[model samples]
Target: MRFLVTGTAGFIGFHLAQRLLREGHQVVGIDNFSTYYDPQLKEDRNTILETYPAFSVERLSLENAPALNAAWKRHQPDVVVHLAAQAGVRYSIEHPQAYISSNIVGTFNVLEAARQHGVKHLLAASTSSAYGANLEMPFRETDKAVHPMTLYAATKSATELMAHSYAHLFGVPTTFFRFFTVYGPWGRPDMALFKFANAMLKDDPIEVYGEGRMSRDFTYVDDLVEAITRLVLVIPSERPPVEGDTLSPVAPFRLVNIGGGKPSPLMDYIEELEKALGKPAIKTFLPMQDGDVPNTTASPALLQRLTGYKPETPIGVGVPAFVDWFRQRYDL
Candidate 1:
């Protein structure tokens, strides 16, 4: 099958595209190489993907509707996985326009392209942050995600609603999966794992937010990608298949939470990193910043029910793997 994957140079997108190519699927990737992080990292990822015979890429932002439309016309992809967005909750606080343009406007273009191009399945990325301020443990797909703590989560929540409208109106099959704190090799620098690993390697003090009280369902990158690949084939339908199935009665749309089903404390995660690096980090505990939730956990029951798969990697295994990659990548 031919797949059009946005943000192909990004952390999750790159891994997903590479996996698809390994399975003998044709992949058309698009990435603007935004300066959100270092563009060199994105370029490096694209370099490896370029070596694949079945992989091709376009350099453009999702906000460019005309360009995105043209690419859709050219590729006519069988599946559209929209993953591009201005990520980072704290970053969104400083630059709200970035979130509006990239998340809202960019996603709108993707939805229109998918609708017009007649793609079979459209899987877009959402976040556990969407469960903003909800005190519920093991957040379910059916839980109300009304109170988004940050502009970033609000934009993502908006995308989910927008996707539902398009799917209902155009009879498009769509899956909006909310991801918990995902981390692994080739991860984003802004993420805690990356920052902590780098700081520890340099013997610098790592900032501990929420006084080491915050918790997250840290999903492994490979596990998240595997769940997505499986969901590619498990398209939703209007008719419900099982109990508590999130299949929309009005449209072929659903929401699934992808994570390890385990929440780890921030301090514990840092300790795991320290173990991986075989070094101690200068710890500086601080208060939680604005637009930040105290904890995020996912109930993988829905994902497992649909795909018979669940994210099983623990921090002990995943953190060390990332440290190893970090050392090799930076020659630390």
Candidate 2:
């Protein structure tokens, strides 16, 4: 299959593209290489992807509709995985417009391109943060996600609606997977695991958010990529609706949560990092920051029904893998 994947330089995008390439698929990657983090990291990831003859990338942003459409026309991919976006809950508070442009407008452009090209399936990334203000233990795909605490979440939720509209009106088969706290080797530096590991290695005190009360359903990157790979074939209109399915009645659209349905405490994750680094983190416990949630646990039922797999990597194993990669990447 020929896939047009956005954000191929990003953490999850890099992992997903590599997996597809290994399976002998042709991937046409698109990334602007935003400086939201170290561009060096993005360059490094793209470097590895470039080594695969089946992979090719265009340095452009989704905000640039003309460039994006031209690339889509050139590649004419069978599947389109839209993953690029301005990410970060707290960062959205400071720069809400970035989320508006990249998350909302960027996704809009991708949907337009996919609809125009009549792609076989359009898969995009959403976040568990979309399940805002819901006190449910394990978030199901059918849950009402209207109460977004952050602009970031709001934009992602809006993306879901936009895709649904495209699916309904244009008859585009679309699937948006809401990701949990994803972490692993070559993970984003801005994410919690990377920050904690970097601080611990530097002998700096790690700030424990929510006063260590928060917990997350952390899904390893490989598990997430595996689920996504399997989901590419499970188009919304093709599959019979399973129990707890979020498939839209009117549109060929569905939302699946890629998680283990397991919520581990924040402290437990930190402890795993400590074990990986073989050093106790100097702790600075702090209250929960604004736009932060206390916990997130995905149901994972629909994902398992659709793909017969769910993320099961525990922090103990995942944290160690990340630490090893971190050490090797930085020569620590």
Candidate 3:
């Protein structure tokens, strides 16, 4: 499949592109290379992708609608995987506009491109944060995701609705997957695992929000990429005019959960990282800040029903692998 994947420089995007390229798929990737963390990390990731003969990289942001539209028109891809977003729950509190621009508006651009290009199947990234204030264990696609606690989640939720609307109106087959806490090699710097490792390495106190009471289903990067790759073949069927589980009644669109179905406690995750790095972190437990959830777990039943797989990698094995990569890459 000739694919146009956004956020090719991102952690998940890089991994996904690599897997597809290794499998001999022609891939066209794009990224803005923003300083949200460090453009150098994105550049390094892109460099790795450049080694692939079937991979082509373009430097651009989703905000550039004209440029993105042209790329879509040029590639006329078989599939579209939209992963570019201004990602950070805490950062959203200060810079809500960034989330709106990148997640909401950026998603609008992708939907438009998918619709205009008449793409076969469209799979975009959503978040577990969309299940805000629900207090539901094992979040399902059928659960109501109306009350988003943070702007970041709100924008992502809005993108889901926007995609659904496009599917309903234009008959575009769209699959939106809610991702849990994703971590492993080439992870974002703001994520807990990365920060915890860096803090522990430098002998600094890693801030433990909610007094270390939170838990997360930290899906490994490879697991995530596999789930995504599998879904490329499972596009939503034609709308059948149904009523439950967000199965689009008007178009071929569905929302699926891609995550480790089991939840791991925050302290447990930290302990695993400590063992991986051979350094215990200085504790700084604090109250739960705004826009933070105590836990997030996914109900991968739908994913299994469709793709015959669920993310099952444990932190014990995954964290050490990531630590090894970090050590080798950064000389930690």
Top candidate by lDDT:
2
| lDDT by candidate, in order shown | 0.93, 0.94, 0.89
Q: Which number leads on TM-score?
A: 2
Candidates, ranked, lDDT: 2, 1, 3
- State the lDDT of candidate 2 residue by residue for 148-221, as single tens digits: 99999999999999999999999999999999999999988899889998998889999998999999999999
Worst 10 residues of 2 by lDDT: 237-246
Higher-scoring candidate on lDDT, 1 or 3 = 1
Note the residue pairs that clash in candidate 2.
none
TM, every model: 0.99, 0.99, 0.97
User: Which regions in candidate 2 have their CA more than 4 angstroms from the true location?
Assistant: none
lDDT of 3: 0.89
Answer with 2 or 3, whichever has the higher TM-score: 2
The clash count for each model shown is 0, 0, 0
TM-score of 1: 0.99
lDDT of 1 at 205: 93
